[model samples]
Structures are given as structure tokens and as C-alpha cells.
Target chain A: MKAWSIEKPGSREVLKQIDVDKPEPQTGELLIKVKAAGINRTDTLTRQNAALKKPYPILGVEVSGVVDSNQSTDSKLNAGTRVCGLVNHGGYGEYVVMRADRAMILPDELSFKEGAAIPEVFLTAYQTIYWLGELKNEEKILIHAAGSGVGTAAIQLAKQLSQATIFATAGKPEKQEMARKLGASVTINYKEESFDERINDVTKGTGVDVILDFVGASYWPMNLASCAADARWVLIGMLGGSEVERVSLSELMRKRIALKGTLLTPRSDEYKASLSREFMQIAMPLFKEKKLQPIIHTVLPFEKLPEAHRIMENDENIGKIIIKMNQ
Target chain B: MKAWSIEKPGSREVLKQIDVDKPEPQTGELLIKVKAAGINRTDTLTRQNAALKKPYPILGVEVSGVVDSNQSTDSKLNAGTRVCGLVNHGGYGEYVVMRADRAMILPDELSFKEGAAIPEVFLTAYQTIYWLGELKNEEKILIHAAGSGVGTAAIQLAKQLSQATIFATAGKPEKQEMARKLGASVTINYKEESFDERINDVTKGTGVDVILDFVGASYWPMNLASCAADARWVLIGMLGGSEVERVSLSELMRKRIALKGTLLTPRSDEYKASLSREFMQIAMPLFKEKKLQPIIHTVLPFEKLPEAHRIMENDENIGKIIIKMNQ
Candidate 1:
């Protein structure tokens, strides 16, 4: 099988197309023929990490494909069944092994490219907003990086499922407009205006009940200033920066804030399986009914995998970027 | 009626004994004839707060006494029924008002001083460890300020209810010994040794599952270092300064830590009532069985309330400091 593997960790320059043995299905696993793979920031981080050895695992972490073989006889994920879900690794290849329970059946109405975009962002948004953030109906949520994959998914999920009032922040006009179109009641150009001031004005100084913070250190003070009493803050990404200086713990105590930091990739297999199952049960029907849609920015061919990584690294894409594998 | 009220927000000199009118109970409320009152750090903080106007609210927030009057006809509480509870204010007086639903029936085995020690510290500990920290059986927990009121209460509750592995940190030898006696598996003298290093050595780098932090800024880095993945850290106090410099959000994300800051005093009446009912139901039996007991350091006469505040301000007391009102 043809796969994109890093010879040594550095940049896109280290990426090389090489021949690798096809993955085999273990017990309770399914061998899938990759149709489409989604690109994420985690891939770039893995590429830049010096600790990863040569022949580094394939880049992507999510895929949409057809089950070529299934070891579990009782499961519905038999040969030729279309599915899409997160993987431990090795998604940037012709074939990959997936745990049977983690796979979400791809609906007939959606294409493989769309399916590839659904798992990582939607599942992350679901886990962060509902499971961790505990967002409720009639509550308010402030989602930063509104143009990013998880940001877009969170806005949609918070809007459709919880009927929450959504406040979105983006650096660009196009991104802010897109966020507004996707059920955001208010959108702010973070580069042009101070979001905390805007939040204070809009909320009448009470602030939002929940915040999905992707920009960490750079936004800490603003996030702190924009939280209501007993607010839930879930940090999913630190895109702006990571080092925060002179933080006052008393402010958090006074407001009674709950701040949680998480990454979906490092979770255990059992946790992923459970989250995937719950997400599929609740979201699949919406996907089939066209009430929820996966936002895709571009679909690059298999040979243009490096280009896809570059697009994501530069933050030029509005939503998910996909790498389509030729049959 | 004799009452102790702060003339202004200052030191012990500001606290003066003055005659005030007896409090009256409203609907679903009880008029408590105060027998004992507990002193807390919140009382000292209120004394130091410069924003408070002249003739500030009475010092105490928790008391144990007999019900002088009960307005609720259907409730079990009647005149002369022994009770202890948290009050909104005016606890440092001959008479105070308590919500009928928030009062706990005093067991015959405990004295008025012991009952007074139970409300503030025990409720804070239970809410922090169980409600917020979510400590489970077999999980490891690190409790800071091991000799303090809430610290002692938390150690006993975690040990008795969840059977959790308890790690306690305190500045004084006497405090450490008291923590050990209360069922802490490991007690570290924080003044003598670095707690994070000691914790690293003991847990073999896995760190604790939950942490009860009262030191705030001074312990932020150490708390971050000592947390295991998915650890729940509840911050209830900031005794050792509140400003922290140079915090890394990436570290929190890597560990997936959940940090919550709360103060029980600011909670709504409904929330307090619910928590009080739940705590009474689960813990009252243990109190009756002699399995749970409140720790008291000193009991000063009501007229010497200023001395009690001084003792707490100096951090000289081990457990709760009580003010006993003569019959």
C-alpha cells in the first residue's frame, strides 16, 4: 500500500510517499479501504515533534471508507459496508485497521469526503460542549476560532441540539460571516475589536454561561473577564499561545468557573468507542435528514497530500480539508 | 440581645460587643437561640475587606443552638429542638435566623461546640471533595492545609465515605499528626519538603486523581505538576496569595485536568437547602455511629470573639475555633 510517512520529524519537507504493508484486522477490528482522510492540526504537530522516530505513523487520524474485512462475525460492519470514524493512526494510507465499535456508518446521502470531515470535529465538539461544557438550552456559549473545524461544528451543535445563544469570534470577515450564517447570534472580528468588551456589552455584563476556548494564553484574561458565575470553560486548542503571566486565582473563585483542558486524540480506546457510539446515535439521524452538514473547505487528491498539510498549517481553510484516495 | 459586630472593616480592634435587637424568623424559617458559633477564615476576610460600610454584618456564619421558634407547621422542628446550621448572617449574636430546610438535627452524642464546628468546615469539605472534586473509591487525593478546619473535615469524609487514598500537606508537625490520625495515608510537611517532589516520588510520577487546594498561587505550579490525567482540582481558598506568574495551558491540556473554583457562601438558597438535605441524609448516620466527628481547636466565650478572630488571623488554630455563648 502507498502511504505518506515522515522520514524524520520536521516540516512538510520531511514527508515522503513510501510503500508500507497493509494493516490487518485484529479481534473485534475491521480492515477498511480508505476513500477519504481528513487533515487536522494534530498531524502538523506530530510532524514537527522531534521525539517521533523515522518511519513515523501515517499522518491522518480520521477516515471514511468501506470495510474490506471484519473479524467480528456478529457485527453489522461486514465487508463492503461504508463507514467513517476516528482511528488510532495510519489514516493517510490506502488501508487502515479500525476498531469495530468505533466505526460510524456513513449515510448514503453524504459523500466520503463529507464523511471524512464528520468524525474528528463533530465528535470533539459534542464531547467538549455537551459532555464537558455541559451546555444547556437557553444558555449562552462563546466559541473562539469560529472558522476552525471544531469551532464550526460546535456552533452548529450548540445551535441545533441545545438551542443555545452562540457568540463567535474570528480573525477574518469571511470567517465571521460564515459563523453568523451557521447559527451564531453574534459574531465578532477579534482582530478588529476586543471580544471581551463586545461580550460584556451584549450580555449586559453578566457574560456567557460556557466558553469554548481554542486560543489559550492570549485569550485567558479576556475569557476570564467574559465568564458569568459558574461558567464552564473548555480549552480544546491553544492556537494563539500557551504561556499566561500573572493569573489571579481569586477571580476564578469569585465567579466559580470550571476550566477543563482536553485533547480527543490521547483518550483511551474504550472512551473513544463510547463517545463515538453516543455521537452516532444522536447525530446520525440529523445527518441523514440534512439538518446537520459537514463543512469541507477543499478536497485534495492523494498525490497532493503535502499540499493539504500546507493548507491546514497556514490556517487558510475555513473548515475541514480532505485527502481523497483514488480507487 | 448581646451581639458582636464590626464597627468597620479592619483588625480585631474594629470588632465590638454591642446590644442589638433579637432576630425574627419568617415563613419556613427558625429563630435559633445561639449556644455556640464557629469562626472561619471568611469571617477574617470580611473583617479585612475595606468596602464594607460602617456597622458591618455580624461576624459568624455557622451556629449550633436550640430552636426558639419555628414557623413551619408541617416540619419536625419545634421549640427547644436542638439544631445546627449555616446562616446567611448575624450568627455572632444571641439570636439568629436559619432556613428550616437548611438546619440539621443535632445528634445527642455531640456537644454544642462540636455541632458548631460541623457546619462550615464539614459542608465546605463535603461540597469540595464529593460534589466538585468527584473523588471515588480507591482514588488518590491530596489535601492542602491538612490542619485547617475544612482540611480535617475533608480527610475524614474521604476516608470514611469513599475509602480513597488520602495524601495531606500541612505546615506544622501537629497539623500533620492530626491529618494522619484522621486517616491520611501520607502526610507531607509542606514547609520542610517540596510537596510536588514528594508526591512524584510516592506516586511514581502518576500523581493524584484529585486535589483540594487552599494555597492558591503559591501552590499552582506544584498542583499542576502533581495532577494525574483527568484529575479534578477544586480551589476553595487563596491563603498564600492569589497571583500566579507564567502558567502553561499546554500542560493542563496534556493532562486533561479539570480545575474548579468555588465558595459555598455565595450559593443560592435552593442550592444550599438541597446540599444540606443530601449531606444530612448521607452523613448523619455516621455521626450517630461515632464514625464521624468534628474537630475543634479552641472554644472562647462569646465576649472574647475578638480573640477568636485574632487566633484565626494568625493561623495558630489547628481545626475549628468556636465561640460559646453562656446560657
Candidate 2:
């Protein structure tokens, strides 16, 4: 089996393709023949020797594949059942091993590329909006970087579960329309005008009930300001920076907002299981109903992994970039 | 009528007893002859020239008094009714005007000084524990500055409402005992013990569900480390300082914690009204049943305003320090 392993993490060059023995499924696990995998900023960070307590990691967090083998004799899944999940460590391999609970039955209507795109972003957005944000149809959410994979999914999920008002942000005018098309009630081009100004103007200074932020610590202040009284600010990523500069607690206190930070990879298996159960219950139905669609920006060959990483790093792509696993 | 007023913002010595026209009740308002006013950190901040936007620069926030006059014809309250409530712009005078909606009937068992002690602290504690903390009977909450007025109230309230585990932090051993007597299962001498060491040892590293932090930004990291997987960090004051150092959001993400900073003073009339209403509904019965009692540390003469301010600034008193009107 060929896997992309990080050898002495530094940059994209550190991602090395080497032949390795195919991993076998442990008890309560599945051996999946990887069909596709998605690239994320987390991969970049883990590759750059940042925010890793564990090292020599595989680079993919989301993957689409077929069940090649099951470890548990009593496993319910069939051998060829289509699946998508966080492949225990990550996806960048010809065959990835995952906990049986981590695997979700990929919707029949969706493609392998779309299935690969679904797991990471949707789970993050779901955890942010429902678990922490405590969102309802009566509420409104501000999705920052609405052109991104998580942002795109968040827009649709908010509309699906809550059918609530959504405010999204994009860096370019073209991206703003794309976000709007994805289900944003209001879209603001952060390049031309401040999203905060637009938020205040649109919401009549009431602010949004929830803010799903991926821009990281730099957007901390604006995210706080953009929240309504008793708002929830869920941080899924810190692309811009890590430290929030001069955090005004006075503002957070006045609004009674919750500033929550999250990392999916490091979370306990129990937590991931709970998230998967949610995906199985809520998102699966929505997918079957054709109410939700995975936003795949590009589907490149597995060998073009470096290009995929560069595209995500450049922040030029609006949705998930999938790499087909050459089995 | 005579009242303690600060013509210009400066020190405690600048506080003066001056003759002024008594405030009259407006529509839906009550003119109360203040019997006792709780001396709080808000009064201290106002004295230190904390920029206030209110039209009238009155130094008080919570007062217990006899109704001197009433303008709300339909209000259940009448002249001479004993009540306690949140004050409007002006409260540190012979007669202070307040909305009838913001007032609550004082329990017959409680004295004016005790009644005055209850409002500010109870409001802070109740909002922090129930509304923001989302505390459950089985869960534990960590209260910082546990000897302070709000901390005292939170301990009693959490004890009264449900059988929740409480970890309290106070500066002195004596304060720890007092907090323990008030129902804190464990009291850490914050001045001595590393709360991080004790908290980790106690929860077996699971941490607390909610953190009531009024110590300001200095306690930020401690609060984060002390919190559970889904922890809620509510900030009410900055006694230690507002600038928090080393906010590692990675910890927040890994734990899925909600770090929120809050202040009680700047809330809109609606929020204050809601607070008053909820307090009345949930806490009134507890007060009537004698399950709740206000902890008054000292009762100083209104003329001794400077001394009261000094006591508060030095953190000399336990619970609340109330200023008697007609001493």
C-alpha cells in the first residue's frame, strides 16, 4: 500500500509517498480501500510541525472508500458498503483503517468525491452550530469564510436544520455570490467593506446569534462584536493567527457571548462517535432528501497531492479539494 | 435632602455629603427613601473615573428602601412598601427614582441591609450559574474570589437550587472556611495552592463544568485548564487585571470550552427586568423558605462612604458591605 507520510515535517516537500504494509482492521474497526481523500488547513499545520503532540502523521482527515474488510466478526456493514470518515489517523493512503463507528454509510445519491468532502467540514460545522451554538430556526448565524468547505456546508446545514437566517462572508465579490447561492441570506465581500459594518447595518445592530469562524484569532474581535447578546462564537480554525491581540473582555461580558475553540483531530473517540451518530441521524436524512449537497471544488488525481495542498494554502478554492486514492 | 455625590471623578476623599433636590417619581417609577445601599465594585470603578455614559452620574446600583412616592398607579407597590431593586441613574441620595418593574418585594425575615446585599450579588451569581453556566445538579462549578459578594451568593444559590459540586477559591484560609461553611465542597486558598494542581487532582483531570471568574484576565488560563470538556468561562470583573496572557486557543478547541466575559452593569433595561423577574420566580420562594440568606460583612454609615469604598478596594470585607442611609 502507498501512503503519504510526513517525514521530518517542514513543508509540502515533507509529504513523501512510500510503499507500506497495508494496515489491518483492529477489533471494532474496518479496513477501507480509499477511493478519495480531502485536503484541509489542519493537514498543512500538522505537516509544518505545528500543533502536534504526535508526529509522523498521515495527512488526510476526510476520506471516501469501500469496506474492504471488517475486524469484528459481528460487524453489520457489508464488504462493499460505501463509506466516508476520518480514517483513524488520516486519509493519505491507499487503504485507511477506521473505527466502525467512525464510518458513515455514504448517501447513494452522492459521489465518492462528494463523500470524501462530507465528513470533516460537515462534522465541524455541525459541532459548531448545533452542539455549541445551540442554533434553532428562530436564530441567525454568521458564517465567516462562507466560500470555504466548512462555510459552504454550514450555510446549507443552518438552512436545513433551522431554516434560519444566515450571514456569510467572502474575500472577493465573486465568492460572495457563491456563498449567497449556497444559501446565505446576506453576503459581504470582506475586501471592499468590513463585515462588522455590514453585519451591524444588516442586523440593525442586533448582531447574529451564532458565528462560525475559521479565520482564526485575527477575526476574534470582529466575531465578538458581530455577536448578538448571549451569542456563541465557535472557532473551528485559526488560519490567520493563533493569539487574539488585545482581547476586549469588556465587550464579551456586555454581550454575554461564548467564545468556544475546537480541534476535531485531537478530540476523544467518544466525542467523535457522538458526532458520527449525529451525522447518521441528521445529515444522512438531509442528504437522502436532497436537501444537502457536498461542495467539491476540484477532484484531482492522487499523485497531484502537492497541488491540492498548495491550492488550499493559497485560499483560492471555495470548497473541498478531493484527491482520488490510487488503489 | 442630603446625599453623597462626587462632582468630579477622583478618589474616595472626593465623595461629599451635599444638599440636593429630592428625586420625584416619573411614569411607572417609584421614589424610594433609601434605607441601605450596597457598596460594590461598581461604585469603586465610578469613583476611579470609569467613563460612564448614563445621564446622571449616581454612584449606586442596588438599594433597599421604603417607598417615598409612586407614579405607577397600577403597580402592586405603594408608598411605604419595603422593597429592594436595581437602581436607575441616581441611587446614592435621600430619594432615588427607579422603575417599579425593576423592584422586588423584600422578604419580611430579611433586614434592609441584608436586602440591599442580595440584589447585586444574587443577580450576578444567578445569571452566571444558571443562565450562562448551564449548571446541572451532578456537575461542578469553580468560583473564583469565593469570599466576594457574588461568589458567596453563587455558592448558596448553587447549593439551594441543586446538589452540585462546588470548588471555591479565596485569598485567605479564613475566607475558604467561610466559603466552605456556605456550601463550597472544596475551598482552595488561591493565594497558596496552585488551583490548577488542586482542581486537576480533584476532578481526576476532568475539570469543572462551569467557571465563575470575576478575577479578570489574569485567571484566564487557570479557568481554561480548570474547565471540563464542554466548559463555560464567564467573566464578571477584572480585579486581577483585564489583560489575559497566553490564551492558547488550542486548549480551548481540544476541550470544546466556551470562554465568555461578562459584566452586569451595562445590560439593557429588558435584560435587567428579565433578571429581576427570574430572580423573583426562582429565588423568591427560596428566600421565603429561608433557604437563602444575604451575607453582610459590615454595615457602615452613609456618611462613612469613604471608609466603605476603602474596605471594598482593599477586599477587607467578606460578602457585601452595605451603607446605612439614616445612621
Candidate 3:
């Protein structure tokens, strides 16, 4: 099996393609012949940071593939069934092993590239918006990094599930337009305008009911200032920086704001299995009905894994970047 | 009518005895012949901050008294009924006005001083532990300021409602002993030892499930460090300082901790009414059974209101400080 492995820490040059022995499925697990793998910012950071505790040298977290083998006798998935699922590691390989319960049957309506992009982004967006944020119908929401994978997914999910008013922020003009097209009632090019002021204007000073933030510290003040009373701010990533400058505890208390930090990769297998079941039950139908679709910015060959990382690092993609594995 | 008014902000000396026109009960409101008023940190902060937008000069927030008048035609409360309730202001007076719906009929087993201490502390504690923190039976919780009004109330509530293991932090030895007497399985004198280390030692590095924190910035790092995976840290006050020194976004996300900022005074009357109803249903029976009781440090005459504030500022009280009115 050929896989992209982090040869060293700190640069895209560290990613190396090497041949390795194919991994076998463990109990209640399935070996999937990878068709496509999703590229995420987590991969880039994990490769660059020497201090991160990597479980494996391989860098991918999500993949779409065909079931090659099932270890458990009671496994529902049969060989050759198309599936997409999250993996702790080794997704950026010719064959990857994943827990059977976490695997979802990829709908015939979706392509392998689309399936590869769905699990991480959609599940993260769903968990944050519905489970953590508890976004209600008719409430307003602000999605930061609106051009990114989870941001686009959140917009689509919010639109399809509820009558929420969506506000979005992206850096580039084309990305902003894409967000607007996706279902954003207001899209601000954060590079050109203050999102806080824009939110205040659009909401008539009441502010948005929920904010999905990836840019930490740098946007902390703006995020706090742009929240309505009893607003929920869900933090999924720290793209900009980590240490917040100054937080007014009084303001947070007065507004009754809740700040929740979450990540999917570090979650337990049981939690992931439950989330997969929920996503399949609630969101899969929407996908089958074409009410929700994956927003793929670009799909590169598996050999060009470095290129995918470069594109993500430069923030050039409007949505998910996928790497198609060579058959 | 006699009342204590903030003559001008900046010190306890500014709290002055003044004569004011007796307030008539507005529609859906009640006029009470005040019996006792609870002194809280909010009162002290309001008195010190000249910039605070006070609704009225009178500072008290919770009161217990005989219902002198009811303005609503459909009001369940009648004249001469003993009631304890939350007030936006004017509680530190011979006569006070409160929303009829926010008033709870005083339990026969409780005294007026005890009733006055109950509404603010118990409601705040219940909202934090049960509602915000979502504490479960057999889970562990760390309560800071364990000798304060809310802390004492929380200890009692957690003991009666759930089999939660309570860990408390107080500044003084006597306070620590008082916390243990109430229900805390372990009590730490925060001034004498590192709470974070103690928590780690006690939980064997697993950490506590919920943290009820009021000391903001000073305890922020410790709070984050001491929380177990998926823990909820509920913040109700910022007695230590408002601005946090530094926050690690990675630490917060890795732990999946939720930091919630809350205040009871700023909530809408309808919201408080709902909370009141919930408290009555879940906690009132415990009071009747004597399973829960308000811990009053001292009950002084109304003229000694300034002395009560001094005691609160000096952190001299073991539990709630109450000021009683001589009708």
C-alpha cells in the first residue's frame, strides 16, 4: 500500500510518498480500499508541529472507499460496498481501516470525491450547529470562515433544517459570493469590512443568536461584541491564533453568552459511532433528496498531496479539497 | 419609606440612609412590607462602579416580606401573604416592589432572613449546577467560593437532588469546615494550597466533571487545567478580576470544556419567573423536608446595612449575609 507520510516536522516538504504493508481490519473493523481522501487544516498543522502526539505518520482523517474486508462476523457491510468514514489516522493511503459502526454507506447519488468530503465537515457542522449551539428556527447565525468546508456545510444544513437567517464572513470576493449563493442572507468580505459593525447593522443592534468561529483570539472581541443576549459561540478551530487579548467577563455575563470548544478527531469511538448514526438518519436523506450537497473546491490526484496542503495553507479553496487515490 | 441608596459610587461610605416615597405596586407587580434583604457582591460592585447603569438608587436584589399589595387582577398572591422574591432594585427598603410572578410563597419552616437568602443564591446555584453545568449523579464538581451564598446553596441542592461528589474551595479554614459540614466530600483552602494540583490528586488525574467558578481571571487557568473531558465550567461572577491573562484555545478544544457566563439580575422577568417555577418544583420540597436550608452568617438590623456590606467586602461571613428591617 502506498501512503503519504510525514517524513519530518515543519514543512510541506515533510510529506513523503512511501510503500507500506497493508493494514488488516481488527475486530468490528473494515478495511476500505481508499478511492478519495479529504484534506483538512488539521493535517497541515499536525505535519508542521513537532510537539503534536501523532498516532501514525499518515496524515488523513476522512476517506471514501470500497469495503475490501470485514473482520467481525456480524459486520453489516459486505466487500465492495462503497463507504465513507472518519479514521484516527492512515486515511491518506491505498487502503485504510475504520471502525464498522463509524462507516456509512455512501449514497449512489454522490461521487467518491463528494463522499470523501462529507463526513468530517458535515458532522462537525451538524454537531456544532444543532447539538452544541442548539440553533432554533428563525434565529440568526454568523458563520466565520464561510468559504471553508465546515462553514459551507453549516450554511446548507441550517437552510435545509430550519428557517434561520444566515450571515457569513469570508476573505476573498469570490468566496463571499459563493457563501451568498449557498444561503447566506448577508456575506461580508472580512478583509474589506468589520463583521461586527455589519452584524450590528443587519440585526439592528441585537446581534446574531449564534456564531461559529474558527479564527480564535483575533476574532474573539468581534465575536463577543456581535452576539445577542443569550448567544452561543461555538469554537471548532483556532486558525488565526490562540491567546485572546482581553475578555470582559462583565460583558459575557450581561449577555449570558456560552463559549464551547470542540473537535471531532479526539472524540471516543462510541461518540463517533453515535454521531455517524445521527448523521445518517437525519442528514443522509437530505443528501439523497439533493437538498444538501458537498461543496468541493478542488480534487487533486493522491500523488499531489503536497499541492492540496499548499492550496489549503494559502486559503485558495472555497470549500473542501479532496485527493483522489490511484486505483 | 426608609432605604439605603448609593449616594455616589466609589465606597461603602457612599451607601446612605435616605427617605423615599413609598412605591405602589404596578400591574403584574407586588408591594411588600420588607422583612429581610440579602447582601451580594453585585451590590458592592454596583456601588463601586460609577459607570454602572443602575435602574434605581436602592441596591438590594432579593427580599423576603409580607405581601402588602398585588396590582394584577389574576394574581395568586394576596395581601398579607408571606413571600420571598427577586427584585431588580428597591429591596433595601421598608417597602419594595417585585414582579408577582417572580415571588415564591415562603415555606413555613423557613424564617424571613432565611427566605431572603434563598431566592438569589438558590436560584443562581440551581441554574448553574442543574441547568448550565448539567451535572449528573455520581459526577464530581468543584465549587469555588464554597462558603459564599451560591456555594452553600449549591452544596445543599447537589446533595439533595443528585449523588454528586462535591469538592469545594474556600479561603479560610472555618469556611472550609463549613463547606464540609454542608455536603462537600473534600474542601480545600485555596489560599493555602494549589486547587488544580489538589483536584488532580483527588480525581487521580481524571479531574472534575463540573466547575462552578466566580473568581474569573485569577482562577481561569486553574479551572481549565482541572476540568475533566467534556466538563462544564459555569461562571457567575468576576470577583477576582475581569480580564483573563491568557487562554489556550487548544487546551479548551482538547478538553471540550464549555465556559458559560451567567447573571441572575440581568435576566428578563419572564425568564426569572420560569427559573422560579423550576426551583419551586425541584427544590421547594427539599426545604419542606429540611433536607436543604439557607446558611445565614448573620442577620443585622436594617440600619447596619453598611456594616453588612463591610463584612461582605472583607469576606468575613461563612455564608449569606442578611439585613433585616424593623417594620
Candidate 4:
């Protein structure tokens, strides 16, 4: 089995392709033959040994694969069944073991590349927007990083499921246009104008009811200023920066805001399993119906994994960048 | 009618007794002849025109009284019916009007002072601990300002309702003892030792599941250090200060903590009515059984309302400070 592994933590140059023995399925696990895998910002972080606490070896967190061996109680998931799931790690390998409960059956209508793109971003978007953010029907939502994988997924889901009026902020014009096409009622190029002021103006002073904040410190002041009373702010990523100077708790209190911080990779297996079940039950049909499409920026051959990382590092991709693992 | 009102925003000297016309009940409202009133920190803030948005004439928020007039649709609340409720304002007067839906029938076992004490602090505590915090049975909770009115009320409610393991932080020895007596499993004299270190040591580094924070800026670091993964921190007050010099969003994400800020005063009439209804259903029976007790530090006459404000300002009292209106 060929897999990408890091001997030591550093730049993308540290990622090494090597032959390794295939992993065995443990109890309540399935041995998956990787067909396609998704690249995420967390992969870069894991390569640097920043967040992923596991011993360095494989990098990917989400994959579309075929069940090679099943050791779980669920009879529906048989060997050779097509599936995609969120893994603890090792998705960049030929053979990766995933918890049986976390695996979602990939619909026949979607390709492996599209299936690979759905788990990480879609589940994260689901978790942040619905579970943590508690977005209600006809509410207003402000989604930052509107071009990112999770951002695109969130816009579509909020549009299809909640009927929420979407406000999006993206740096690139292409990203802004994509966000608008997906669902955003108002799109702001954050580089050109302040999103808070624009959103405030559009809303006629009352800010959005929910905010999906990916840019943390850089957007904190605006996020604070852009919340309606009893707004929910879910922090899924901090791409711009991490630390904010002079944070005021009084403003949060006055608006009665709920700020929740979350990361999909760090969540427990049980949580992932539960989230997968709920998401598949609700969102899989939408994918099958082509109502919710997986937005892919590019799909690269497995050998071009380094290029995929480079593209993401440079923030050139509008949505998910997938790696066809078997190619 | 004689009432305590503030002409200008200032110290306790500004709280002056004046003659005012008795208020009449509007639609869905009841005019009550006040028997007793509860003093809170918000009352002091109202004296200084801090949080309350209403005009600066009255100085109280919760009272227990007999119904003088009813323009409300509720058939049970007739004239002279004993009732207690949260008011938008005007609880310090000889007569006050409150939304009928917000009023609760006083249990025969409780006095007017006891009823007065139940509305504001108990409701706020309930909202913070159970509603926002989502504390489950046997989970550990850390309650700050353990001797303050809401703190004492929360200690009692969490004890009787969830059977939670309570850790409390207080400045004075008497407050600590009162917290213990109410139901706190452990009490920390916050003035003497670092609460975060003690809590971390006790939980074996996992920290508490939920925290009720009243001291804001001063407790930010300690509160961050004292949370378990997926912990809920509800900020209901800012007794210490409101600004933090440096805040790390990454740290909050790593812990997956939910920080919510709330003030019961500014919530809408419908929200107050709903909260009052739910609280009465769940907690009133326990009060009738004497399983829940309102801890009162002193009962001062209406003329001595200024002294009550001074005592609260100086942080001298233990539980709720009640003003007996018709003494």
C-alpha cells in the first residue's frame, strides 16, 4: 500500500510517499480501499503536527472508498460497498480503517471525487450552522470565508434547508460571485469594504441572527458589531489570526450572543458517528436529487498530492481540492 | 403613592423618595399594590442608568404584591390576589403594573418577601444554569459570586433539579458556608486562592462541565482554564470588569467551549412570560415543599431603600436584600 507520510513536521516538502502494510479493521471498523480523498486546511496542520495528536504517518481526514473488510455489527455495509466517511486519520493511504458507524453509503449518482468532498466540509458546515449555530427558518446568516469548502456547503445547506437569507464575505471576486450563485442574498468582497457595515446597512441596522466565522481575530470587531440580539456565532476556523486585543464581554452580554468554538477533526468518534448518521439521513437524499451539489475546485491524481497542498496553502481554491487516491 | 425614584444617574444619595400617581394596568397587565420588593445589582445599575433602557424614574424590578387592578385576560388573577412577578420597571413604588402573563400565584407557604425574592434572582439563575448552560444530572458546575442573589438561587436550584456537583467561588467565609449549605460540593474563597488551580486539581485536569460567570474580565483566564471539552460558560453579569486584554479564539476552539452572555432585564415581554411560565411549572412545587429556600440577608423598610442600595454597592450582603414596602 502506498501512502503519504510525514517523518517530521514542517512544510509541504516534508510529505513523503512510501509503501506501507495495509491497515487491519478493528472491532466496529471497516477496512476501506481508498478511491478518492479530500484535502483540507487541517491536513496542512496535521502535516505540521499542530492539531492532530496522533503519531505522524498519514494525512487525510475524509475519503471515498470501497469496503474491503467489515468487522462491525451493521449488516447493511458489506464488502465491496461504496462508502465515504470521516476518519481519525490515514485517508491518504491505499487502505484506511474507518469506524463502521461513521461510514455513509455513497449514492450511485455521485462520483467518488464528489463523494470525497462531502464528508469533511458538509458535516462541518452542518455541525456549525445547524447544530451549534441553531439557524432557524427565515433567519439571517453571515458566513465568512464564503469561498472555502465549508462556506460553500453552508450556503447551499442554509439555502435549501432553513430558507435563511445569506450574507457572505469573500476576498476574491470569483469566490464572491460563487457565494452569490450558491445562495447569498448579499456578497461583500471583504478586501474592498467592511462586511459589518455593509451587512448593517442591508439589514437596516439589525444584524444577522447567526454568523459562521472562519476568520477570527481579524473579524472579531465586525462580528461583534454585526450580531442581532440573541445571535449565535460558531467559530469553525481562524484563518486570518487567532488572538484579539481588548475583547469586550459587555457587548456580548448586551446582545445576548452565544459564541461556540468547534473543530470537526478534534471531535470524538461517537460524535462523528452520530453526526454522520443525522447528516446522511437528511442530506444524502439532497445530494442524490442534485439539489445540494458538492462544489469541487479541482480533482488531482494521487501523485499530485503535493500540488494539491500547495494550491490550498496559497488559498487559490474556491472549494474542495480532491485527490483521486487510486490514480 | 410614595415611590423610590432616581432623578439623575449617581450614587445612593440620588435615590430619592417622591410622590407619584399609582400606575394603571394596560392590556394584558395587572396593577399591583406592592407588599415587598427584591433589590438586585441591576437595581443599582438602573440607579446609574446602566443596563435598563427605560426612563430613569423607578428603581426596582421584582416585587410580590396584591392585585389592585387587572386589565389582563387571565381569569385567575382577580383584584387582591396575591401575586409576584418581574416588572419592566416600577417595582419600588407603592403600586406597580406588570404583564399578567409574567405573574405567578404565590404559594400559601411563602411570604411576600419570599415571593419577591423568587422572581428575579431565581429566574436569572434558572436561565443561566439550566436553560443556557444545559447542565445535566450529576454533571459538575462552577458557580461564581456564590453569595450573590442569583448565585444562592442557582446553588439551590441546581441542587434540587439536576443533583449537580456544585463548585462555588466566593469572597467571604460566610458566603462560602452559605453556598455549601445550599448545595455546593466544594467552596473556594476566591480572595485567598486561585480558583482555576483548585478546580483543575479537583477534576484531575478535566475541569468543570458548566460555569456561571458573574465576574467577567477578572475571571476570563481562570474560566478558560477551568473548562472541560464541550463546556458551557454562561456570563450573566460583569461585576469585576468587561474588557480582556488578549483573547485566544484558538484556545476556545480547542476546548470546544460555548460562551453565552445574557441579561434578564432587556429580554422581551414574550420571553419573560414564557420563562416565568416554565419556571413556575418546574420550580414552584419545590418551593411549596420547602425543598427550595430563598436566602435573605435583611428586610429593610421602604424608607431605608437607599441603605439597601449602599449595602449592595459595598458588597456587604449575602443573599437577596428585600425592601418591605408597607412596613
Best by TM-score: 1
Deviation of model 2 at A225, angstroms = 5.4
Q: Over 4 Å off in model 4, which ranges?
A: A50-55, B50-56
Residue pairs clashing in model 4 are none
| Model 1 agreement with the true structure over A1-327: per-residue lDDT tens digits | 999888789989988898989988889999999999999888888988998875578878999999999987646798999999999889999999999989999989999999999999999999999989999998999999999999999999999898899999999999999998889999999888999999999999999999999999999999999999999999988877899987889999999999999999999999999999999999888988887889999999999988998999888999999999998
> Which whole-number lDDT from 0 to 100 does residue B90 have in model 1?
86
Q: Put down candidate 4 lDDT per residue, A1-327, tens digits, no spaces.
A: 999987678898888998989998989999999999999888898788655444676889999989999999898898989999899889999989999999999999999999999999999999999999999999999999899999999999999999899999988999999998999999999889999999899999999999999989988999999999999999988887999998999999999999999988888889999999999999999999888999999999999999999999998999999999754
**Model 3 residue A177 lDDT?**
86
Task: Assess candidate 3 and give its lDDT.
Answer: 0.90
Residues B77-113, candidate 2: write the lDDT tens digits.
8988999999855667777988888898887888888
Interface RMSD per candidate: 0.5, 1.9, 1.0, 0.5
Q: List the residue pairs that clash in candidate 1.
A: none
For each candidate in turn, the TM-score is: 0.97, 0.79, 0.90, 0.96
Q: After superposition, how far is residue A240 of candidate 3 from its true place, in Å?
A: 1.6
Q: What share of the true interface contacts does candidate 4 keep?
A: 0.93
lDDT per residue, candidate 2, A1-327, as tens digits?
788877677887877887888887888888889999989877887789755554476677778899999885645666888988875565888988888887898878888888899998999888889987899776989998888888888999998889889988888787788788878899888777788888899889999999888877777767767889988888887767777666667777778788887777778898898899887887887887778888888989988898899898887798899999656
lDDT of 1: 0.92
Candidate 3 residue runs with Cα over 4 Å from true position: A6-10, A13-22, A48-58, A68-80, B1-23, B30-33, B45-59, B67-81
